[model samples]
Target: MYKNIKVIAFDADDTLWVNETYFREAEHQFAKLLAKYETENKIDQELFRKEIENLAYYGYGVKGFILSMIECALELSNYKINPKTIEAILNIGKKMLNEPIELLDGIEEVLSSLQDRFKLIVATKGDLLDQERKLEKSNLLNYFHHIEVMSDKKEKDYKKLIKHLDIHPSEFLMIGNSLKSDVLPLIEIGASAIHIPFHTTWAHEEISEEASNNFKYHTVANIKDVLRLF
Candidate 1:
């Protein structure tokens, strides 16, 4: 079914491997820090909701996430947490830079299989350095002919990517975890999109529904299963 697609762009992070799990763990630590000032459940719930709101304003990236964490820390602690406490939380986020690299199951094999017929691309958004490092460490970098590390994934970004690739939207396919950031924008530009839900999703990425027929929103259980389509 995917044989006719010329360019298949994949989202990194949760779509490629484990990412939301790391963020969830970090948020748990932040909740612990708030225990003295507020109930853990209240703190966690508020932070989770606020994080989603922050994403709408700042979008996704390490810097925005750090800011959200700072905001949550301050609010949950009733504004008593000092700069040092904030800095410590920020440091915890920075340490994610060195997190171990591991690809989703069958990612390697599927990339290998698709390489023969499709032009593979990695289209991910985040802090440039961290995203680049994760790609490099995964050893999956070699498979993609192009890499798009963006601060945001708006429709314009998709247009630019298509223009740069010199391919029409109909010939391109975007595979990702987030309907907000990945699928919707690309589909609006007439490209096909595939949605593969990660086990643990970022608060900002939760979508109301998958795309309807107008966008060709295919669904998959996991990244590895993409091979079956090809």
Candidate 2:
């Protein structure tokens, strides 16, 4: 299946190290901070809405998420949120940025095994500085030929990356956790993709089953499982 795939791209966040888990933790903390203003359920829903709405302006990553939390807190509080509470919300983002990189089991093994055979790169969407910091901390940087911190993961974005690599879509393969960002777009562009779902996913990244059933891609239960496909 991979015979024509010369360039293999992997998502950076949940696929390489623990990411969505931290976002979940931050969301829980955000809900607690605004408990008096609104119910947890309401806060959670509104924050998600705010994040999606802000994506165009802030793009993705911890910074955008922090702004969304603050916006949600302000609206839920009727613009009466405490300054210290705002400070605490920022701290949530800081903590996430500082969290230790917990590499998923079998990531290195897969990278190591594939590095010798394929041109590997990190095809992900997030703040460039934060993504670079994580890669540096991951100690997995050397294994990859390039790191692509994308603004968004759409069909055009993947097409641009493929064009930059001077490779055909058929020779490009993507592996990541989010089907919306990683799998479906590649399929649409005539590229191969493997879906390795993380236990957690952002609401924006989730897709309907019917939306994905039409696409042809391999969904593996674990990262190591991808090796067998090669």
Candidate 3:
């Protein structure tokens, strides 16, 4: 199916390494720190709402998440959240920032095998500095022809990326875990996509499976399975 594909783009976070897992852990820690003010469920819901609301203002990544956590803490505490709790929240973000980049199984092997056959690039959305740091730590940076840290992942964004890379939509293939951010948009833009499901996904990135039925894309059980496609 990808015989014509000349450029293979990958989603860095969950696809290449563990990301949402860290966010989930941080959320748990945040909820525990605020347990004095609200139930964990309510805290989780409010934090998610705040994150979505703040997406445009802070964009995506750990810094934005830290800001949202702090805002949620203040609101849930009725503006009397303890300064120490705020410090704890900031510490959670710092811990995540320092966590090692644990690459998904077979990522290196797949990249090594395909590096000679296709132009590999990382097309992901997140805070630029943090993403660059993780990529540098992963030591997978040498495999990609380009690194695109997108502000958003919509059809228009993919269109712009294709134009920037000087490739026809038909010549591009994107592989990622989110159907909303990764698969559907690429399909809409006339590019091929492969969905690799991660164990956990943020609520905002989840979409009904029915929404994906309209498009033609591939789903794989493991990252290594993608090697079979090319």
> Which one is best on lDDT?
3
lDDT of 2 at 196: 95
Which pairs of residues clash in candidate 1, taking residues 3 or more apart in a chain or in different chains? none
Candidate 2 to truth, TM: 0.99
Give Cα-based local distance difference scores for all models: 0.81, 0.94, 0.96
Question: Can you give the TM-score per candidate against the true fold?
Answer: 0.88, 0.99, 0.99
For model 3, what is the alpha-carbon lDDT of residue 64?
A: 100
What lDDT score is found at residue 57 in candidate 3? 100
**In candidate 1, what are the lDDT values of residues 128-226, reduced to their tens digit?**
878888898899988999999976788998998899999888899998888788788877888888888778777556666544445557789977777
Global fold similarity of model 3 (TM-score): 0.99
Off by over 4 Å in 3: none
Off by over 4 Å in 1: 1-3, 48-59, 82-84, 210-215
Give one digit per residue, the lDDT tens place, for model 3 in 208-227: 97898899999999999998
Going through the candidates in order, what is the number of backbone clashes in each?
A: 0, 0, 0
- Candidates sorted on lDDT, descending: 3, 2, 1
Candidates 1 and 2, the one with greater TM-score = 2
